[model samples]
Target: MMMNMFFYMGLVSLIVLTLNSKHLLLMLMSLEFLVVYIYFGLFIMMIYMNYEYYFGMIFLTMSVCEGTLGLSILVSLIRSYGNDYFQSFNILW
Candidate 1:
C-alpha cells in the first residue's frame, strides 16, 4: 500500500528530474522530492525493523546540508548569470 505509493512517487520525481534537466530550479525541486521519498522510506523501514532512529536523524541532517549546499551554489550562479537556465551558463571558462 504505502510502499507502492512511495515507489510511484519516487518514479514520478525521477521522471520530472530527467525531463526538466534544462531548468536548475525544476531539477533541484525534483531532487528534493526524491530525497524526501527516501527519508520516508527509511522511516518506514525503521518502524518495521524496530531499529533506533539515530541513523535516520543523521541521514536527515545530511540531506538538509546537501539541500542547503545546492541552494547556495544556485544562488551564486544566479547572482552572476541572472537566471537558472543551464543554457545560460558555460563550463569552458
Candidate 2:
C-alpha cells in the first residue's frame, strides 16, 4: 500500500510536469517518465497475475520503439528550430 501510494504520487507529479512544461525537451522527458512508471506498474501486475514473459517482452519492445521515435523527433526539432521551446512551434498557425 505504501509503495502503491508512492508510485501514484510519482505518476501524478510526472503528469503535472509534462502538462506544465514549456520546453519540448522537458515534455519529452516527462513523457518518458510516464512511460517508465506505467511499465513498472504493469510489470508488478504481471508478476502478481503470473502472466507470461512474452507479453512483458512485447511491451518493453514497444516502449523502446516509442522512446526512440520521440527522441528522434526531439533531435529533429532541435536541429530545425535551434531550441526546444514550445512557443516557437507555429506549424498550425
TM-score of each: 0.93, 0.81
- Best TM-score among the predictions, by candidate number: 1
Model 1 misplaced stretches (Cα beyond 4 Å): none
lDDT of 1 by residue, 1-93 (tens): 877888899999999998998988888889999999999989989999999999999999999999999899899989998989977889524
Residue-wise C-alpha lDDT for candidate 2, range 4-91, written one tens digit per residue: 7867867785777758678877777777777777777788888899987787788889989988998898898889989888888787
- Which regions of candidate 2 deviate over 4 angstroms? none
> Model 2 — TM-score against the truth?
0.81
Q: Which ten residues in a row have the lowest lDDT in candidate 1?
A: 84-93
Candidate 2's displacement at residue 82, Å, is: 0.8
Q: Which one is best on lDDT?
A: 1
